[model samples]
Target: MRVAVLPCCLFSLAALAGCATGSKTSEVAQVRMVFPVQAPARPQCDAKPLERLALTGQVASQELIDQALHDSRAAHARVMRDDHVADASINPARLNLRVSVDNRIISSSCG
Candidate 1:
C-alpha cells in the first residue's frame, strides 16, 4: 500500500507542477479580416412550379419535396413539423413547408 500511495502522490504533485508551469504562458488573440468572405449569389425561387406538385394535407415524401425544391430553385428548404419552431427570417431562395407530425405538407411557399 505504501509503495502504491507514494507513486500516486508523487504523480499528483508532478501533474500539479505541470499545470502551474503552463499558467505562466500568454497568448494574444488576433483576428484579421483582410477581406470579408462573400457568399455566392442566390437566385429567387418561383413557388408556382413547386405548388403544382402540392397535394396539400397529404404526406410529403422526401423525393417529392426534393423535386419541388429543384423546380423552384430554392437554395434551402425549411420543413416545420408540429411544435417545431422555425426562423422567421426570409430568404429569397428558401422554400418553407409547414407539415404535420406525420410529414404531411400543410403549406409550401418560397421566401
Candidate 2:
C-alpha cells in the first residue's frame, strides 16, 4: 500500500511539472476581488458652541439658543429646567439645554 501511494504521488507531481516545464518562464495568475463599502451617516450634534453661549452666565436668550441650535446642526432643541427631570432618551440630532431656576443657561449637550 505504501509503495502504491509513493508511485501515485510521483505520477501526479510529474504530470504537474510537465504542464509548466516546457515554457521559458512560468507566469503567475493573480485574482483580486473588491467589495463596495458604504459609509455610515454621522450626525453633527456638538455642544461646544452651545457651551460657549452659556459661558456668559446670563439667561438663555431665545435668539442665541436658536442660533446655537442651527450652528450645531441639531434637528431639534429641548430646553429643560435645571431641577426638572428631562427625558433620558438619546437623540443624536437633538440639542439639550438645561437652564437654572433663574433662567440662566447652566449646561448644554447633545444626547
Candidate 3:
C-alpha cells in the first residue's frame, strides 16, 4: 500500500509541473505597448489683450476698465467685487477681471 501511494503522489506532482510549464507564447501575444506625447504650452496673459493694465492691486476705475476691454479685444468684461478671485463663468476666449471690495484691481486672468 505504501509503494502504491508513493507512485500516485509522484504522478500527481509531475502532472502539475507539466501544466505549469504549458505556455508563454499566448501571454506574450496578448500584451501591447503604448507611448506618450507632449502637450503644447498655453499663451501668457501679458501676450494677450490685457497687457496694458497695471494689474495686481491697482485701483480700478472706469477708464482703466475701458482700456483693458479695448486692448484685450474681448467681447465683454465682468467685475467680481470680492477680495478673492471668483469662480470661472466667463468664456475661455474672454478676459476675467478680479477686483477688490475697495474697487482695486486684485488681479487679471485670461479664461
Identify the leading candidate in terms of TM-score: 1
RMSD of each: 12.6, 10.6, 11.3
Worst 10 residues of 1 by lDDT: 25-34
Q: TM-scores of the models, in the given order?
A: 0.57, 0.56, 0.48
Per-residue accuracy of model 1 over 40-95 as CA lDDT, tens digit each: 87688889886577558878888877887889988878888866988779889888
What tens digits encode model 3's per-residue C-alpha lDDT throughout 1-111?
999999999999999887766655455545532334457754333315465556677777788876776677655667777765667564644566778788888777666
Displacement of residue 109 (Cα, Å) in model 2 is 0.6
For each candidate, the alpha-carbon lDDT, in order, equals 0.80, 0.77, 0.67
Steric collisions counted per model: 0, 0, 1
Q: Once model 3 is optimally superposed onto the true structure by TM-score, how far is the C-alpha of residue 1 displaced, in angstroms?
A: 99
At residue 96, what lDDT does model 1 achieve?
83
Give Cα distance to truth, residue 34, candidate 2, Å. 11
Candidate scoring better on lDDT of 1 and 3:
1
- Between candidates 1 and 2, the one scoring higher on TM-score is 1
- Looking at model 1, the pairs that clash are none
Question: Candidates ranked by TM-score, best first?
Answer: 1, 2, 3
| Model 3 regions lying over 4 Å from their true place | 1-47, 83-87
Q: Compute the lDDT for candidate 3.
A: 0.67
